[model samples]
Target: MKNLIYLLFVVFFSTSTLNAQDFSDIDKSPMDVTIIRNENHSPMARVIYSRPSKNDREIFGSLVPYGEIWRTGANEATEVTIYNDMTVMGQNIPSGTYTLYTIPNKTEWTIILNKKVHVWGTANNYDPDKDLMRIKAPARTAAAPIEEFSMAFQPITNGANLLMGWDNTYVEIPFKNVE
Candidate 1:
């Protein structure tokens, strides 16, 4: 009985140590969410994405590459949630969660609002036909470089602007509020 108890303790200890080793201390690009609220402080729209730092490396036209479908963020695909039905870039997008994708170019970017959500990494599972809409947004150079990826919604007349900025470039997608 004593030998059996001792062996059980040893096995438990070994297993606990091994399980603890599975976790990592290193942090990957952190996840972030941007929410747009109305006058009543109600959330109108929100976006969830990972923020990847430049890390002294070239972003866009090189690291991310030009004219390729980017996940819009790092790690998992960037997701956007619309609380109410709205028009995005003249295309009606029903209120729902969606994956936001982008095809970047030197002068412009094709921003897509995809029906697919909660996907991982790039456009590996992308279906262009399922995209709710695709709109051309001009890429504008920022006055200064922004090292981390960021997306936010800015208030506008009867609508909002979805701004995406990273490195030295930025783009804006307009979304009109629906009653």
Candidate 2:
């Protein structure tokens, strides 16, 4: 009787634990990050962003392939808000919320901003007509993978560069700071 009770208890506990486990979205988790640029704007200009690492799992020709449209992140297409208008890659970009995306390759990357906002990745589909602007930048190789993907708006001499990277492929879209 004692042995049977113990066995039943273990089975019940195991089943309950198993049933309570969450397995959804385990394959794609995003790295949460907040990027800010406050140099020439008001008190601490900021933008929220996120990206998942394109690490060990073959980012080059798989996952995020070489020469394919990547939403620049796993979730809501990595949104950003420039408090003041800036010039990116020598092109004028207005201040507002925009969806960020990228086309990656071994040599270069095209950074893009679509007029649309608040959408689940590239699922909603991007229309080139809706593009606010696109900037082409070259990719620089790092000695190693970044482990975790990261995005940050760093203040440059007269602008800011939106930096992105994972697994040695690093790139930046220089946004000429606007006063």
Candidate 3:
């Protein structure tokens, strides 16, 4: 009887633990992260943004629109943290957290780094005067279609490329370490 009780308890506990292991995303748009590491393997810069799936819809020049400011992600404004002082597109930005916004076009995209952080969707209250810097990057065609919006930090000689792509379009913003 004692052995039978122990066996039942083990089974019940194991089942409960298995149920607890289910991690399901409730939000249609899921948050994602991109981290740029230094030579020492420590994070030099990081970005937190949400990924919005295409879902058979037009992504650029239609859903995202052209020549308009976008929050650069889904739910909240995309957040970027710079661990150390860096130069982005020839403009110096001190080590700190900031909101990343973008104005996308068919030919090119303008990347904007703002001093404001913790902003919610679309940056309705975005102040142009608070902009740290704005840089233009030419758009490129992706080799394959990207169904979902994604961002990545591609390693480079001095720093990394902040690459954002969706629906066959690719945009890259370069960031280089200051010291």
Residue pairs clashing, model 3: none
lDDT (0 to 1) per candidate: 0.89, 0.74, 0.92
lDDT of 1 by residue, 1-179 (tens): 99999999999999999888955655568999998887788878999999999989989899898988999989899999998888987788889999999999989999998997778976468878889888999999988999899898999987689999999999999888886
TM-score of every candidate: 0.84, 0.77, 0.85
List the candidate 2 regions with Cα displacement exceeding 4 Å: 1-28, 40-47
Q: Which candidate number has the best lDDT?
A: 3
RMSD after CA superposition, every candidate: 4.0, 5.4, 3.1
lDDT of 2: 0.74
Tell me the lDDT of candidate 1.
Answer: 0.89
Which digits, one per residue and each the tens of the lDDT, describe model 3 over residues 42-101?
Answer: 888999999998899988899899999999879989999999999998899999999999
lDDT of 1 at 179: 62
lDDT of 3 at 102: 95
Alpha-carbon RMSD, candidate 2: 5.4
lDDT per residue for candidate 2 within 38-152, as digits (tens), equals: 6544622344555566545777568888888787868667777776787776787878888787899889998888888777778647667888987789999977768767777
